[model samples]
Target: MSRIAILGEYDPTFEPHIATDRAIAHSSAQLGCEVEAEWISTPDCDRSKLATYAGIWVAPGSPYRAMEKLLDVIRYARENQIPCLGTCGGFQHMILEYARNVLGFQEAQSQENDPYASHLFISKLDCSLAGREMQLTFTKGSQIATIYGSLTAVERYYCNFGVNPDYVPQLKSQSLQITGSDSEGEVRVIELPGHPFFIGTLFVPQARSTVELPHPIVTAFLKTVL
Candidate 1:
């Protein structure tokens, strides 16, 4: 059986965390494959164990116990071509890892972690998106659009922070692309163009997944590793 490492502290009461586990099961069933998904606390994450997993899911619920460790894991996955899926807080860290390592913004930070940082690539959204479902349009021909088989989708958001608009232009590169946006054009999703599978979403797609129909995003992610 293939294994998947869920990177984050797991909370039984957190809806996203629970949904994340269930989403993986639903996808594996849909794909007719057996998968072992393990939740590894951020502070306990080690690259040696991480390399053994077929893929990694950077789970939500942040202000993680070990932020630097979380970022390092992301960097390892990005450089190694490991299929990676990040959502909500996971999405924020993905941008942070890229900014600090790839874009040379070593001081870049998430405003949630530091409101007065020198550079905040991730800032609190003007209006909270918790308990809300919103529509997002995917970039034509992008990986997300192709996976969902559509140009638009409505996903649930349990987050209050997102990628800062001021830094959006800097995030666009040959490899990393902003592939999905809300009606107002606020960035909602990003994907690595050439990697086997590397995607992040400000909204929690796992929350919308169901037993009868697992989310295409999660299914697509599992497909890469399986």
Candidate 2:
């Protein structure tokens, strides 16, 4: 059985947190596979325990207790080629990890974590996306487009921040590609092409998942684990 370690501080009252667990079960049942998913609080996470999981999912609800610890695990996944999926706040921190570790932006940070930081790769959106359903377009030949089986999708969001527009151009390197965005060209999804499965979305795909119909993105992430 493949085990997935979800890195986030789980809250019972949080809809995204609850949906995340269900999404995993939905996908595992659909795949006819027995996969165990566990939530590891940010402060409790370390690379040793994380190394045992077949895949890593950095869940929503950011500004977690131990931000640096969370980023270290994300770095572990990226550097060691462990299949990883990030959504919402996870998306923001994933890019922050990439910026500081891969892009050589040692001072890069997320505004939510450090509002006064000098280099904020992730900043507050001009307008909040909370509880709003919006349309996003995927790069024609990107993995996201292939997984969704469409060039565009209407996804739901519960976030108030995203990749800073000022740093958008700097984020698209040879490995990290900006593959999905809103109609206005705001970055929403990013992918690491050669990794088994390394993708992050600004929208909460888990929120849209149901037992009868699992979200394709979550399903695809688990498929890579298998």
Candidate 3:
């Protein structure tokens, strides 16, 4: 059986984290593939050990114990084209990592982690989407659109922060494509072109997944790794 490493600070009490585990199981069963998913605390994340897993899932429950190390793991996956999925807080860090490493925004930071940082790439949303389900429109021809086989999707979120609108132009103009957006045109999902499977979403697709109805994104990710 293949193994996937879930890099995040585990908190059983957190709903999104719990949903993440279920989402993976649901996807595995739906795909008829036997796989193991191990929760790896962010502080224990190391590039040397990352090779042990077939893929990585940067899960929710942020304000992680070691943000820098978590970012390093994301960078490793992105650079190596490893199948990876990030949701909620995980999505926020993916943008931060991309801004700093790929877009030359070395000072870019998430407001959740650095409220007073000079360059805030990720900032709080005007209307928090915590515990809310919203419609998402995917960019045509993008990986997410292809996976879902449609231009629209309904997803759930448990986050208050997202990609700062101020930096959207730079991010989109560069390599990171804003593949999905909400009705108000806010970025809700992103995909890195040229990567085998690199996607992040402000909405936690895991929350909408079930054993009977596995979310397309999660199912697609597992299939990619398989």
Candidate 4:
């Protein structure tokens, strides 16, 4: 079976682990692949070592250390054309990594980290997204538009911060289209069109998925690799 690397941290879930695990595993099963969770501290990991996974999945967490490792992984994936999916903090870190490394914003940062990195792509939201609903708009000619077939809808969210409202314009101008958003049009999902698969969303798509009916995005992520 093909393998999908889940970049996870030493973390807990305000929700149940089984539910989250099932969401991911259910996606892998539908695509006939194996979902393997990779801890950031794994010994002997490197550029070449990372190439083994067909795709990568970033779970929700602090993403401090996991974010560093994911930066290297996503960079390699971006260059080599592998698939990746980042959800919640996973999504935040992906944007930060791309901004700091790929976009040459050396000090690009998240509110969770420095809180004043000058390029606040992430900031603590005025309200907790916990148990809240959101909507996102897919850009014309973008892959998400092709996937979801339209630009507007509601999604469940569980986050404190998102792509800072200010940087949304600059981010989209840089080919990182802010394809999705909340009802207020805040940035929600970001995507890179050129990559076979590289999409991150402020909402945790996995949480909304199930064995009987998995979410479209998560299923697409698995298909990207398989």
| lDDT for each candidate structure | 0.94, 0.93, 0.91, 0.73
Query: Candidate 4 local accuracy as lDDT?
Result: 0.73
TM-score quality measure for candidate 2: 0.98
Candidate 4 residue 220 Cα shift, in angstroms, is 0.7
* Local distance difference test, candidate 1: 0.94
By TM-score: ranked, best first: 1, 2, 3, 4
Q: Which candidate tops lDDT?
A: 1
TM per prediction? 0.98, 0.98, 0.98, 0.87
Residue-level lDDT of model 3, residues 34-55, one tens digit each, is 9899999988999999777989
Scored by lDDT, model 3 comes in at 0.91
lDDT by residue (92-114, candidate 4, tens digit) is 88888788776788777888878
Q: Which residue pairs show collisions in model 3? A: none
Native RMSD of candidate 3 (Å): 0.8
Give candidate 4 regions above 4 Å deviation. Answer: 10-18, 32-45
Shift in Å, residue 149, candidate 3: 1.2
Q: How many backbone clashes does candidate 3 have?
A: 0
Q: Which candidate, 1 or 3, has the higher lDDT?
A: 1
Error of 1 at 10 (Å): 0.5
